[model samples]
Structures are given as structure tokens and as C-alpha cells.
Target: MDFNKIKEMGLEYAEKGKNAALDLAEKGRTQAKIVNAQSKLYKAQRQLGALVYSLAKGNEENQPLVDKYIEMIANIEQEISDLKASLEPDTVIETTFEDTEEAADGTADAAAEPAEEKPEDDEAKTCPQCGAPVSDDALFCNKCGAQL
Candidate 1:
């Protein structure tokens, strides 16, 4: 009830708020780093695949260049792993090239599939580009981002 006690309580809450904000900011930065590293990892893997493919087709091989790409990709993977570990368990975002490729393939397959009959209510809608379910009021396809 005392004025001094209320002021001390207010200061404690303010300090807690500041700490929470700092923790959240740090998590955001870590998440961004993880995303950047993932992007680099994907590019390096793609390049390595291309190099191997070209070399195979030409009946040749460059072990040094291939090794370099492998090393770069490994380093990026380690960095991403470390960044993910730094994040809280619930906040971690894990991804793999296989998953991404599968998702891309799924999108392509969806787009190739034919659309089904519309519902009688007119509330149900599907994306013309991808055949994904969409809200009737949506202006763009949520799955394929095609304009509706």
C-alpha cells in the first residue's frame, strides 16, 4: 500500500518487460540467421548437384571443386544447426532440401491436376492454377499465389 513499495514493484515489472523484449529480439535475429544459412545451404547443394551432373555427362570429374562445394555446404549446415540449437525448443524451425523439393513437386502436381466440380453453396472454391482449396472471397490462391 505504501508509495515506495508500489514504485519498487513498478520498477521490477519494467525490468522484466525489458528482459522479455531483449530475449524476443535475440530470438528474431537467430531465426533470421537460420533462414539465411538455409538459403545458402540450398544454393550450395544445387550447385554441387549441377557440377556433378555436368561432369558425369562429359565423362569427367573435378574432385577438388566437388569437394569444395561439399565442404561449403557442410559448414552452412553446421551453422544452421548451431543457430537452431540457440533458439528455444518451440521456436526452432527445421527444414531439409528433400522436404523443399517434395513441396515444390506437390505444387507442380497440384497445378497439373484437373479441377473438380464446384459445391452447390458457392462458398467452396479452388485455385485454378494449383487446384488447392481456397476461400470464395480470396482474391489470390493461398497455395499457388495465382490471382483469382
Candidate 2:
């Protein structure tokens, strides 16, 4: 084999390897985004579900809130699918962040525009869904949507 030809083939293979590594890294990053976004989405849904269950117990009209959260979850799911399809270098991944304490103050209007979330942690509560730490009295798992 000619030395120059061997050098040329090595350079080509090295370039191909670099491109493949970059693609793999992008996929890994996209997967992390998907997982984190889905976790937040489930937390939001669980909180809203608890609220609805509470309000519904008192026979209060929570359909509007329920509908809103349903739409929000749908939007999150759509974004997740979009992010999955957007692992390319030119695509932007949009993730949604929702506050889990939206209903913590026990006000109807508190559910309005949510801010950033603060995750709760406790040693006793093992989430049946994701096995993450949660509060003992939690109605829903903070990490996942497991009914406790």
C-alpha cells in the first residue's frame, strides 16, 4: 500500500469518527432533555390531579383548571415529541417548567401562571413510580405520578 494513500484513508476515517461521535453526543443530550422534561410534566400533572381531587371532593367547579392542566400536559407531550425529533444540530429543544406549588397556598387563582419549581425531598417517602425521595404525606409522588 502507498504511504500517501494510507494517510489519506486514515484522515477520512478520523473525520467520519469525529462526525459519528458528535451525533452520539447530541442524541445523549436530547435524551437527557426528554427525561428531565417528562419528569417535570408528571409532577405538574400530579399536583393538578390532587387539586382536582380535593376540589371535586367539596363539589367545587374545577373543570376549568382540569381542562387547563390537561392542555398543559398535552403541550408538554407535544414538546417532548418535538424535542425527540429535533436531535439535529440545527434544531432547538423547548422544555416546559411548571411550579409544583401552584396550589400550595390553597387559592383558586394561585394556579395562575406558575413559576419555577422547588422539588421536595424526604427520606421516608419512596416513590413507587421512580423510587425517588418524597414526603410521607404526599398524595402524589413528586418524581413520578404514583398514587400514594
Candidate 3:
């Protein structure tokens, strides 16, 4: 087993996972912003409906109610403005591992290659007594040693 090759492959996988996680986070932020905007629009429409109802039933008793509704609408509009300003999409600056100095060598780094494992060959020697396969360079079999 080549330990260096394993380490390189692990590093490559880790980098890809990191980038994917960051992309998901960015997408979530965008969706949240859109949902928030829709909620604010719905609330504003409801406030407008209340204002129209109060105007249609004008009376001295309803004057205070109309004033309160106007103030509430103003507050909601301010809140929506602030939310719009705050809901800007999070900016992400993409980076690449290939931008490093080692990547300038132009040999297409081995870490970028897919793993190609070969099957193990049958090169073991057989024990005389137990007939079990032993390592080719072994001096004796672990089980039933027959001077292998």
C-alpha cells in the first residue's frame, strides 16, 4: 500500500467536499432572502387593506383607529426597507487548488488522478504439511511449518 498516494487522494476528496458545502450554504442564504421578501410583501398588502377599510367607514370614533393604522403602515414600510438592505446575497470568492505554485509544474499532479487499484497476484508458497499458502519469502509457515 502506498501511504503517500492514499494521503493525496484523501486531500483531494476533502477539498471537493469543502467547496460543495460552501455552495449549499450560499444557496440556502439566497432562498431565505426570497422567502423573507415574500413575507414582507404579504404583510404590506394586509396593512393596505386595513387602511382602505378604515377610510370607507369614516367617523369621529374611527379617527384614532385610522391614525394608528397609518403609523403601523409606516413602521412596516421602514422595516421592509431595512430587511431589503440586510438581505443582500452573501458573496463568495471561489478559489482553486491549482492556483498554487506546485500546480505550475504543468505535469497534471498525481493527486488529480482517479484511483486505479490492481488485483493482488497469487504468489504465495504452499506449506508442505497443512498445504496453506505462506508468504513467498517466509522462512517457515505460521501454521504447520514444513521448512517453507
Candidate that scores best on TM-score: 1
Best-first order by lDDT: 1, 2, 3
lDDT of 3 at 46: 63
RMSD of 1: 14.5
lDDT of each: 0.63, 0.58, 0.47
Query: How close is every model to the real structure, measured as TM-score?
Result: 0.57, 0.54, 0.33
With a 3 Å backbone cut-off (N, CA, C), the pairs that clash in candidate 3 are: none
Query: Per-residue error at 28 for model 1, in Å?
Result: 1.0
Clashing residue pairs in all predictions, respectively, total 0, 0, 0
lDDT of 1: 0.63
Output the lDDT of residue 91, model 2. 54
lDDT minimum window of 10 residues, candidate 3: 95-104
Between prediction 1 and prediction 2, which has the larger lDDT?
1
* Predicted structure 2, TM vs. truth: 0.54
